[model samples]
Target: MTATRLASVVLVLLTLCSTAVPDVARAETWEAVISATSPDGLGTATVHYQHLAAGDSPTAEEINDHIDAEANRAVTQAMWDGSTRRPWTFDASGRLTTWAITVSEVFTGVYNTAEPHMPMNRLGSVVCDTRSGIIISWDNLFSDKTAGLTRLGEQLETQVAAVASPTELRTWRRSGQFAPVDVNFKYWIPTREGVALQIPEVQFGRGLKVVIVPWSAISDLIAPEFLPITG
Candidate 1:
């Protein structure tokens, strides 16, 4: 073959090789579904959930049950508050706030376990290994537990300081201070740029408090199993 012809062939081969390589960011996906909905004056409750669509996943029944439990809790809380609210008059009726909780199955990645593995994400992820049926907790997602905890704590603190204003922080300190602890924050949601640390609103008597930080800030703490999605 001619020198130019050979160079062209080599270039074509390299292009093909690059194109064939799989991108982890592109490979991750989740199947979204409305697990439950109830409008019986319980603040118009609705729960949207997501799961793995690729592999053997937790059954629909299981997913629905999870959604139902979360939905019911919101409804019950609203009902209790409504009953206790003052001013029981015609003008004061139907003005109560509604409940709408949506769980995004953000970032689906599979990890090695006993048996079949599936996509697991934040919001509704238990990292439930469908085959072995074992729920992977937040602690398990890190290779070095102590180091991971420290890294996560720092990231969260920085995010809170950056997002929460001075007034908000002072108010929070009085009623709901953000405690830097390992177990205090749970269920992290992986997004395109970073992960959102999920802190229950029950602690602060408000909506969910999310602390998002860049992956680079805590990249060393994240396990290889989650790199595909978190990347």
Candidate 2:
């Protein structure tokens, strides 16, 4: 072959090689295990959890370990306390994307009662990066933590106000749970529709409440890498 023709062939080979390479971002593969603890008088605690089933990456191993530990904790907690039969329930569901996995947990009835003589509900979540196997915090989803959280607080107020009565709104604002603080906003996970934010208490008699920050509202606030875009 002439020099120019040989160069052209090499270019084509390189292009093919590049395209054939797998995307490192989606390297991890996992399976969700829907399980429950052995039933006792207390009742069964259930979970939909993810385990790294096919990947050999170190990050996958770490993520698997976290899943096991979390599942164990949930199962143990759900076991009968041997006395209290409040007909309460503890359950978890897992959501997955190529880059992240989130486990959203809920507790209902007596077990999830509010603090300080108040009656509220419980909400929790665990979000982990599939690539690095890192358990990410609510703040970690944002490119600018302060700005994102501020906007999140604003969204919370807007959504909650729409549904809350004047009295309920006043009480929630007093409790500080409606604030933008990290601890107050622990129960959140990204879903296909939007990012789900859970409110532990907004009213005395009312149970837990959830509000979604739509992708349209937060597409710029969250880091693109952590978007949890479903297939």
Candidate 3:
């Protein structure tokens, strides 16, 4: 072995096979499922979600009994609930960068004794990045109080991220006609669970609206401890 010691033992066995390979076996994780199709599409329901940690916080009877058993098998009482939370950190190669989700909805309670219709509080926050689960940033806050009219809401919030893969666009304003609004979405990756967004068609000015959202339609009504950490 003398060609300069066999080229330094083949460069130390190629640096020990690139430091023993295995970065979580080339990482790409997903695990969560729930798919439902309706709005006059006959019927369909598939549920399988079990990934809740990151300081657990999913209650409201597990998102109102899975939205009252998928809205009473689509008969539709229209009751729903929400919650989801997880992912605080993991990036040094560990991946799974961020996640924070909060969703709430309480409908079917409307009274107008001249104008007293309330109840519909929504709060949603989503941040995802684990080698392309998509969703870079999203924030939504909606509150309503009647009897005199008081509705404060917020959404979209000028998001910017998503350089490629499927597609994701964001822009917002809309409150009281701030005007600007653009949210284009299309991203799907869930054989296991996490990342399935398709707006189909959503425009503001020209007014084309056809929205279809899955990923368990926002994680089976939220509150699965904010389920996030897909790396």
The candidate scoring highest on lDDT is 2
Q: Weakest 10 consecutive residues, lDDT, candidate 1?
A: 89-98
Per-prediction backbone clash count: 0, 1, 8
Model 1 Cα RMSD, Å? 20.0
Please say which candidate is ahead in TM-score: 1 or 3. 1
Tens-digit lDDT string for candidate 2 (17-57): 11221333344344444334333334345555444443446
| Model 3 misplaced regions, further than 4 Å | 1-30, 35-41, 46-50, 53-200, 205-231
Tens-digit lDDT string for candidate 3 (1-231):
224322221100001122221222222222233333333333322332222121122332243333333223222211111111211110010111222332211111111112222222111112333232233332211111121011111121111122212233333232222122223332222223443322221232322222223344344333333344221
Q: What ranking emerges by TM-score with the best candidate at the front?
A: 2, 1, 3
**91 in model 1: Cα distance from truth in Å?**
21
Deviation in Å, model 2, residue 145 alpha carbon: 2.3
Candidate achieving higher lDDT, 1 or 2: 2
Q: TM-score, each model?
A: 0.45, 0.60, 0.20
Using lDDT, rank the candidates from best to worst. Answer: 2, 1, 3
**Model 3 accuracy (lDDT, Cα):** 0.24
Q: What is the C-alpha lDDT of each candidate?
A: 0.39, 0.54, 0.24
Off by over 4 Å in 1: 1-136, 163-183, 199-209
